[model samples]
Target chain A: MNDPAGAPALSEIAIKPLKHVNGAAHRWVAFIVMVAFFALAPTFIYPVFLMKVMCFALFACAFNLLLGYVGLLSFGHAMFLGIAGYAAAYVAKEGLNIEAIRLGTIHIPLNIALPPFTPELAILTGVLAAAILGYVAGLLAIRRQGIYFAMITLALAQMVYFFCLQAPFTGGEDGIQAVPRGKLFGVIDLSDVKAMYATVFVIFIGGFLVIFRIIHSPFGQVMKAIRENEPRATSLGYDTDRYKLIAFVLSATLAGLAGATNALVFQLAALNAVHWTMSGEVVLMTLVGGLGTVFGPVVGVLAVLGMENYLAQLGAWVTIVQGAIFVICVLTFRRGIVGELARWIKKPL
Target chain B: MTDDYVLETRELTKEFKGFVAVNKVNLKVRRGTIHALIGPNGAGKTTCFNLLTQFLPPTRGRIFYKAKEITGSKPSAIARMGLVRSFQISAVFPHLSVLENVRLALQRKRGGSFDFWRSERILNALDDRARELIASVGLSEFEQTIAVELPYGRKRALEIATTLALDPEVMLLDEPTAGMTHEDVGRISALIRRVAQNRTVLMVEHNLSVVADLCDHITVLARGEILAEGDYATVSRNPEVVQAYMGKGYA
Candidate 1:
């Protein structure tokens, strides 16, 4: 059948992905099972720790949406993470309330004021702000090639870092501490650790599912096409730059969602989350899991953060251990843990 | 319909610093005719194609497709106007399967190009048309094969099929047979003739035999200017055209 003795008639070709019922059904099953695991995991493990993993997993997945799908690299993605964190914290705690920002010795009393926001609204504000910033930054990053990715990323990173540090509502270097979990949607009291965990879990699962949907969509096909070879895509009438920018913005928005959730969960939005190193950390997480695979980033978050949690007793030796694990993983399963698994299973995941 | 030409260039010129790549060359591709742009190395044949496609903007020129001025149009905009092109290198999306590679072009037929939220399975509606195109190009057997895994000659075939899926009224092929094997060349030449039955073709070709066999009109370029333009017999008989483009072996 593979031999081309004669061409198959127009009606002869059988539809594949659409009709591949087992793969589609199994994928849904896998998703449901994942939801069950996360739902039940808090019973056996610390809710806060799991929340941390979910936040990072969501962030890594968002980053992967750009890096893996569209072949874009955001060197300063931490800007999105940090900016969103600040926005969420600011909205939740102050909501345009310009109290005072302490800079070393000077205290600047600010009069900027707006009504306080609900938790979900605060998160929405962060995500939207991130999306806007991503759009501006993405405008500067060329659609094809990684040469501009580093340049644009660094520029945005510096600008965002300063904004996060100096903004009066952000509490400067101290960040917005003791942010009230507040009532989620004027109903659920997130002060309960389990309730907070559930909210964060919802965010993680939602972001993960969205990213998954985008990748498997027709939009995803074009993104992959651009990634495979952009010139070809351009020739085929695709406004490649627009697609890339949209992908970049979407990636940043999701990352913002993660950061906003993290800020709420810990009741703190620190300057550290917005720092350049945070961006580097997300890249590491995604690479460790699998750069392009769907579950790769989540798996990577599990490995990296889990190792940190489990190896804290070793202190400085943990770095050595972590470095060794990364080295071994790179040498052995270069495609990443989930990437290698996806390959073994012969699935697009 | 006012002009006999489907695609035309008026004084199309491109320069790299002080050196001129394409020097005020006028090109007219008649509708429903196979037009070939033949030239030697560095004769600006590819540059001319690039300018016509707006991939490389000309220093000074005007391009007209279907009698409308398209000088300021973007490469994609021009492509959207039914003037599609193939690259000197095979231009199919390498990681996508042949079916997908073709279906992507067909996706343009249905609107909502940026519908990121919808499932790609909806694109399955286009599989039949994509398969028909694949079969037309003798690639029905490789519909599921990843483009990168295809044999070199077959990759070009896949590209043609992908290009055809765009449903262009005018096709620009930049050395469609570049670096192809002799047998592959013969196969692609016949394929080109077959596909060009209805559409106008403007091609930059190195192979003289293919130009003579398939092209109704030939334009010879050398040192960034048109050396000659006519039927194959007339152009090949020109001593200057032979010396500049065809070489002594052909003469």
Candidate 2:
């Protein structure tokens, strides 16, 4: 037998064999349909609620970047999202004031201060922070494979969570609250619900397009190759570790973008963002939509957030319902909603 | 100082715990010649192949490729230096199409850019070459088929095509015909012969007929050591080679 340990798992096998049928046309149609739906959604659905769903959708897409394409299971991805939220919130509330230090010989007073950063700058800062954190975390985590990789990421994330909990900036239990939405580029006021919703819609669409591009890029092709057969990829002269690390950083950065947007949308950065349960939630969303399917995360986030919104009255029963959905999806529709749809259409989503 | 050889190993050894898998084995493959490493089931052929490819690091030894010491180099770095190896098992990306598989290998030759913003249509430039490779391997008809869905023989053919896409200077084939039908063996033999014309081919093969037909040089190994080394005709007639194959009492 071939290397059984190296072979993908049975569940992973089910997700393989992507079929592309009129791929470009299908993607265009999907994009149009999504934009149309978002355009009309505010008239019937609540704008704030839609913004929340979009935030989670972007988050799930970012998480799927590693799990679906790269075959990495990161149980600690919430740390990126959570850290980004804190960073964005801090920037929005207190702004940035970097004081330059004077060394022994050279006196370099490179002090800079910006009072209350714009929402765009704050989000950019959050994304950059996440990318850096991803580099450090990925450097350590990618040394191992499969379960060990997942464990290392989770442990590191837990460390970050503890840091946030103890750190004075995070406000311990209450978190950084009432963070100002700030102006967009110091021009457009984000205080208006419609304006904020429009910004989120654009961000979601932008993030979604970036992910779609990644899945269809040459780099993405190599990433999938590494996922399918890593040793073979190495033999083909790809430094697969570097590719995986870059992919991890990219995924984390996108997740951070989602988190920063969410913090601005809700005017808060709370412990719930960094909690382990957030990681599980993203996983569930990705799984429900489809592990590797392109539009699966969007469908998944909507389904999950919609259930949470409607089932709010059921209290603890919401968790039970979500669990039931997860079970049903795994047992019957393992390919996920969008995955099954893609399989049926014989096209890559 | 001789540069006639493409690959050479000096006293290459690998140990699992205390047992030696490949012990003090020296090998050399002349430039642009087809060489075969043959041994019985427990003769450490695959282990030796792995050591050369840097898949498994040697316990103690030195490996040289193109007159450069590469014992400590990474598998990927060696591949970049034009020393590539295939697996005993079909190593094609199961989900990618045959064309995409070859194209992906070709993409490595293009450039290393982690640019996620650019569209993959830029890869269409590589499609012509990828198609040529697929056609060379007689897999043009199955270019669009997902690799996992292809028949076992066809999948192996795709693996070869992908490997060839890299245009490797020294191609190491590990049991290219390990689990194939007679027809597949013939086709793959022909493919290997054609691809080896411009490059050095080092193969670990169990089929003696393939070795005799294709190999310009043969090395017979037994009990983690080289037993005979020469052309197939000369090595096949070696008394120890006969004993290694026929067993001591039978010989």
Candidate 3:
């Protein structure tokens, strides 16, 4: 039997239909709430610690972009963090106000052009570098999926750690210290910690917004399709690999944004920035916060960073605690804090 | 009418090591006919389907759809050309709601595929298309159900409905009635007939009765070679077809 020629359209029904699997009003409300918290946080907490929290929160958020949205678990995100940190630190501290005067067949100026590099320039460089590295790393990591993908990232991160340790530009084990925060457009004094904190907050929020937009977009649908079934996505005429690679680069660029901010905020870029442990830390943050939810990483970063602030004197006990939390998350809290709460509320967090 | 034949394979051959899975196969499917490819197990039915759809590249020959050669084309490219193949088993987004799964496919079908900013509108629009597809496939009652949560027969029906969301000119279904109960089979058979009214359908089925009842023509394949080809009555009585099914003719 043929379908009726003129029927009431499927669009004109009782229910308007859920436009998105994740609710729009809920997400918008969440964004407003997050902005309110970010605005009020400085008044209640120490500015430096709050700044540090903001930096790590941004870092964790960037890390979550790959793991949560794309369903890719990365273990070497620290490469982007560390590389960008060192690069920004080096540019701010030594490279910015250098001289080029003639010295024994080498023309180096005595008074270098003091056109001080802006924060925007530093962050842009950081994003570009991270995207490039991510392109290369993702090409290799995406060749294998699931647990194998994690292992490949972990191994590559170890290689980066060793490279940073041996490379003289990175200052070997000492790293580049006394990194100047530099000007916010060659005008604002970044030494004013409040201004710096505001700057970091803006970058973090901007990066977060871009990520939110992406995950909610049509491009994001392809990613979910790839995550669910790559073969079927391919059969549906989607270039799945390119989508994965783009996701990887986007995640890395945001991670680099966090790294550049970290370098500026602390006035130092250390070997610890690139270490495998740092990579593991971000994974722990995402896991404890929520693996797939939007605001999960922020919660995760705040929790982990808060613990670190109090337990800094506990030495290796912090590592032990972090490991325990990871185990707990894997075995008991597969949904993480936010994920479980969302389930209880019967709404997406 | 030249463009109406949605799928055509010319001397398509697939060889794995020394074994030929599909050999010198030429297939022509009209734009809106439920073309059934019925054969015994291992008659290269699956392989031929795969080759025509470019799941596996043919060692020899080419495939054309809508007057365009599709040899060596990627599966996604072929699908984008309005030809989509559903696996024998159910293929669906299990974690997503039935409406969401269909909407995703509809989003892909529309040119608004890359627009992340406007997905909300597109997905909203797709619900109507999804509902129509669901109703067409006799799944209107379960429109909001999760695909994986559905019963086995229902899941298969959902898979077909999901494929329809692509608005394909030609649909390749491998064993659309496999492992189905008698009632379920009859329902699916009717649905298939309805869908085939306006779209080309190429399916492989072991259920001979379903073939006899639904198919416009029959192609019998034995050991990767065409054994018989004609209407159901002619092919069913062909000596080679009887020999392949029964193992030997009775004296």
Candidate 4:
């Protein structure tokens, strides 16, 4: 076997091993189960609370897309979420109306009026705004690595927070309050709680699937490669920075979608949405759910929100309880709830 | 100006602050030959290798691959031109399976679209060729194992397989047989020889025996400069070469 002088014939080599089956089947099964559970949940539980959970769940998933897959810990993701909330609120309230004029002898009274902005259009505008902001922030933030990257993003997010605080359109302390939920595509009235809950659930599932698809795609494989060994990926002819930037922008846009949906559900976009505390909460949710697992974020958001709802009477003890849970998760189950469950099942959840 | 040489460096130098790691040195690796860059520790063999591979920009000098200047190109850009380098440390994607690693390398060769929306099942087309490469590197059994879970020798083998998947015209291996058992070294040396039949190989190897057996030409560096250059027999016989190794307290 250690024949140094003579080259071994390729024919003598052993047969190639069978490819390992991926966890795709398990993931899809889990997704179906979760969707079914949610569909039935509103019948028993409060629809509004469930919608809130779905919103945060989507946010956590978006944040995990970068943290788990790309190995980037963005400490300012709330900026995207908050900014998108503001954008959606503003658009839904103001109704995006563009004036059209014909220059000539006669001016026709034809105004391109798109008044009474729909929920779908507002959400799209919010996502677009988030994408544009992500591009600008990601460009500056990706210049650093590890802690410095975190700090840079945090600093950028703080600047945005202050801008929101001072900006007239944001309404400063009060925020853009009482935003109209409006209609979905100018037909379905979102004012109805059931309709609103259904819309949010659909948005959450759609965003979740997109993230899942991204994680399983070729681009995702390369992103994982970059995460594992960036220099190796670079040597393999991948522009690592470009891939990272793309992941970052995508994560931000999804977070924005979650934020927009949250605004529509609550009928308000406020300072709490854009605050650094919200960013930390998303991280905590993702961590508790499992960093890389597909369904981990959903479970994590549910647990956290469930505790908050149940422990409202406990006052400061809620924070202490959250801290205790985080510590326990880190020490006993470092992989988070879904991660540990996935490990037990011997499948990638 | 000659096309016979696949890679050439002119006055390649790298300085970290005031201390020069790689002094101004010219290296010419002829096409389709196993060229070894051998030297004692701190001889700047790795530094020179890094310079040529675009891992580190040269403080001063120019690099030419196939007579085209690629002095300040990015590592990936250089790799696209069929000049790829393997890391001294096994640089395989740790979490990915061996087959997946090879497929990833092959995907780079294909230069496919950056469509993140498409299913990864599309990459299955490269499986047949990836399996061939794995078998060639004697890693057929470990094709489905995560790269990080493989034993040391197998990890190195997987790294080689991944590198080979690139179909590089000129391959640069940094200490390809470093930290290997005697048997692993022998097998890899033979593998390197087989692989170099059509492609040029520029390697920084510490195992002189492997170099003597596989390399067609050798460049000996000492104190960040070329001490001797020739075939192994010629360079090994040179008193200066012996003295440099002996000065480093090696017999």
Candidate 5:
């Protein structure tokens, strides 16, 4: 029971706890389902296409971490993806070499000037870079909410895109090309199609799990509370702005992870990565997948990517059809594919 | 009632642009007692609460809790000092399960763990606290119910449980029993009594009988100023209090 001072052991002295909802079981089940789907994805579609789906699926889920869980609708999320892709491509092309020098009397062999371009290192660099950019943007973007929030994020992304266009390192309009897949830890060659497929799948799955863990954590609950009622959360003694900043950074990092993986797979980082259309595309993926459902974005990305691949020749029509889907989903099916399915299943999958 | 004071306001005034919403209102609420603020609509009861909680900056005022000046403090800072106000309408996480809603509030009170890694045991403890509060508020059966799915009365109960989870030293109820069935009103009123025994309570109520039944003291306001302050029986009999409620000239 709480005492007179209003300070009590919240979890320890509480009267009773809720029935345990075995979140671990739910996570394991989801993991199994995702793996099973991935295994079967290549059977019905091109393996490269499947890889692309997984990459965007991870990206959408990351974006959902902010939009769905934290109640932040960031319209400039592509900035993270594109910037990370650029970082990954530039790193791969230059190739890191570590230089070992002998400071003492002992003879040290000559070493490369930078570290090797391993997949893990590339992804790590990408994540860190995205997180830093996200932090800076969140500082500015979090001052407003609702439509203002969306517009500020969009403007910030456009600023980044223009900067990328003029930056010499990004190769301007031509973008980065012939980006090596790079040897994994200087061992496993990613040039092998099957090897590359496995690598991309692992990276996407890893990012997804990281986000899943964040959502289930206590921090995630705080984010949800802030989303539901910010004034209330503030009155409850939380610095809500700080929480939003952290969420933004985390979302950007995961998005960057996905973009980096994509660039490595395709051996190119194109202008599309930094475009506002890319930002819009991810929103659609999250919305179609189910705005807040854990695995909704996976389904959304697969469907959208499939449509794009199959309708390549249609060009402008693809935009029209996608626009129609957005309108239909917003007006009639607000819950989207995963949400409706979750309703049928009676759980927020 | 000198030592009995838990919250006291001295010349608290709130001005919005050029208009004064709450004009120089002085009030004192005893510790562990239910005090009600009653007035005609737009008498500034809500504005007074907002000022005391620091949700709105007071144009001119001083608020003291346990004799410490809290005027012009941030709402969260004030709340952290053991004062919390429940909104007129239900302010809850509707999509979250009833238990999750209460647990989140509790988790916040316990220095919410922002750990993005590791298990959520910190939240598990809050869930335990939430369940207890839910049961105490007669919502044990609806522990897992989504807040949005609950009948109107139950949502009221959930909101109260959440505010209680904040471990407030003084609880401000802004029409806690609003928009409820008579039966539900009785239940919430009973809960209010049980909660008041452990902490000071102040509420804004439109219903005279509800105030008469629950409050030890009632403050009547009209057009941003206190018209009368006394026990319910005394204030109800006051000509000024009657005039304010009846929309007549104050005698």
Candidate 6:
């Protein structure tokens, strides 16, 4: 294993697909096609379903930034997702509450309220909150590498899960519901379905573009160099740990971006966004789509969400079906759909 | 602490699990000289090399570069100070392209390693010098190939190219010709001599021919202790050197 950060769970050699891939023009063409597809698809598909996929796609890409580029597999990324969603929802709806944080028999009472914010402000608030949390968590987590890194993140996320369950502002099991979409910049009404769809579309494309830019930038080049050979990077005078932390914080901010937008799309924020299972789902999306490729997660979202949509009638069996499909994906296309395709075409997707 | 020598080690020692890999030894390389550390396997030549670079911490020792104590400095910090080393085993970024490997070596001096917003075209500027380095190492044909995909000797050449890209004040070559063919050894020896004109070079080599041909000073180690230190002619004449090195060289 060349990576000093520690070996990945799936040794890169077994799953390494894209080797002779350099598709600059093809990548741009694909991006344009993606923009067109998403813009036109909602006209035919249900708007909310499209919006959900877009949000999750953004979430998966942000998670992929850490896992794919930096080679840091965070198993606890959902805390960022859920925290931003809760923050956005809380800010969107003005509310008051009196509750006590319980520690066995000990209690600390909390009373809080806030004036409602516009949808954009609420989402920005969510993103800012996630960035701070990510910075703190990144500081603690980067001390360990590889599987230990994953485990530490998982442990920290569990703490967040419990906090959401006990926090006064969170509204407990019910979550903050019916968060008013309000208006975008106090003019474009988010209450309208098309307007909300446009907003989610812009956010997703913007994030996806940012991820693409980072992958190609000078900083991103050094980042890939670190992921490939950390000691060698250090030998060339790079502070690799610092780069890892920055990538972590950026990924967290992007995940928060997705979460905040997703909450607005549904007009609700709940524990589902923050659950460990949500973290698992993002991993699955990144893996099945292509662990490192740019477009992998978007296609991955479509597959996962499509399965859920068609299989919802199966109730509890959905988990079994999703698991079985993941097994097949791991067996058949471990490089993922985009990854294998990139290998075949000799172009980076 | 004299300014004459570019690098000096003060009683450098290392132990692993009660086994002394490198015992207390003092070493110095004068400015603009090729120094050789020639020893048989397990004489701790590589361990000594690692200790000087601080890649492996010395269990009990201190290292100085230009009279400044750098005993506990980070490997990257040591690199930034213009003290650079190549690996005993070729250690280029395996997945990175040949152009990329050399460019990365050229990257650190310019700073802004955190410029995520800038275009990658900024790095393309470094590629010309990277190509020149690659060509000097006779790896121009493998310019686009990943370092791992290159043949073993070619990978070593890539490693050398990256090392040269730094243009360091001091160069440490750990078995530079370890995997190369006869012709490559001559080529690399010439390259080393050319690069060593202005800078200091400290090498750990098993090849007696390279040590005799290029080094200005030779230090022979046996059982992690210096057995001889002088010019090649002087060191070769020592009975201990003949017994320790030549006896094992033939074996």
**Index of the highest-TM-score prediction:** 2
Q: What lDDT score is found at residue B238 in candidate 6?
A: 86
Check candidate 4 and list the clashing pairs.
none
Judged by DockQ cut-offs, is candidate 5 incorrect, acceptable, medium or high? acceptable
Q: Give the CAPRI class of candidate 6.
A: acceptable
Candidate 5 vs candidate 6: the TM-score winner is 6
How do the residues B1-251 of candidate 3 rate in per-residue lDDT, one tens digit apiece?
Answer: 38767788888788899998777877777777777887788889999888877888889998888888889988888888878888876777665567767777887766535554443554575677788888888788887765667887888888888888787888888898899899989988988888888878888999999999998877787778777888899998888788888887541
Lowest lDDT block of 10, candidate 6 chain A: A9-18
Q: Number of the top candidate by DockQ?
A: 2
Q: Which 10 successive residues of model 5 chain A have the least lDDT summed?
A: A1-10
lDDT of 3 by residue, A185-256 (tens): 888989998888789888878878877777767777776667656667776767677888888888888898
Q: Clashes in candidate 4: how many?
A: 0
**TM of each candidate vs. truth:** 0.92, 0.94, 0.86, 0.93, 0.89, 0.90
lDDT of 5 at A237: 74
Backbone clash pairs for candidate 6 read none
Model 4, C-alpha of A102: deviation from truth (Å): 23
The model with the greatest lDDT is 2
Tens-place lDDT per residue, model 1, B1-251, is 45788988888889999899999999989999999998889999888878887889889988888899988788877788889989998887766788989998998777536777888888889999999999998999988877777899999999999999998999999999989899999999999999999999999998889899999999989999998999999998899987775457765
- Chain B TM-scores per candidate, in order, are 0.96, 0.97, 0.93, 0.96, 0.94, 0.94
Give lDDT for model 5.
Answer: 0.82
Ranking by lDDT: 2, 4, 6, 1, 5, 3
Show model 6 residue runs off by greater than 4 Å.
A1-23, A95-114, B237-251
Please estimate how well model 4 matches the true structure, expressed as its whole-model Cα lDDT: 0.86
Alpha-carbon RMSD of each model: 5.7, 3.1, 6.8, 6.7, 7.2, 4.2
Question: Candidate 2 lDDT, tens digit per residue, A1-349?
Answer: 1212123322233332223333467778988998899878999999999999999999999999898888889989999999999999999999887777678888777687878889999999889888899999999999999888889999998998998899988999999999999899998999999899999999999999999889878888888888888999999999999999999999999999999999999999988999899888988998888878788899999999999999999999999999999999888887778877876776667
lDDT of 1 by residue, A263-299 (tens): 8998899989978878878877887888777777988
DockQ per candidate, 2 decimals: 0.51, 0.57, 0.38, 0.48, 0.34, 0.47
Q: How much does each candidate deviate at the interface, measured as C-alpha RMSD after superposition?
A: 5.4, 3.2, 5.8, 6.5, 6.3, 4.0
Clashing pairs in 1: none
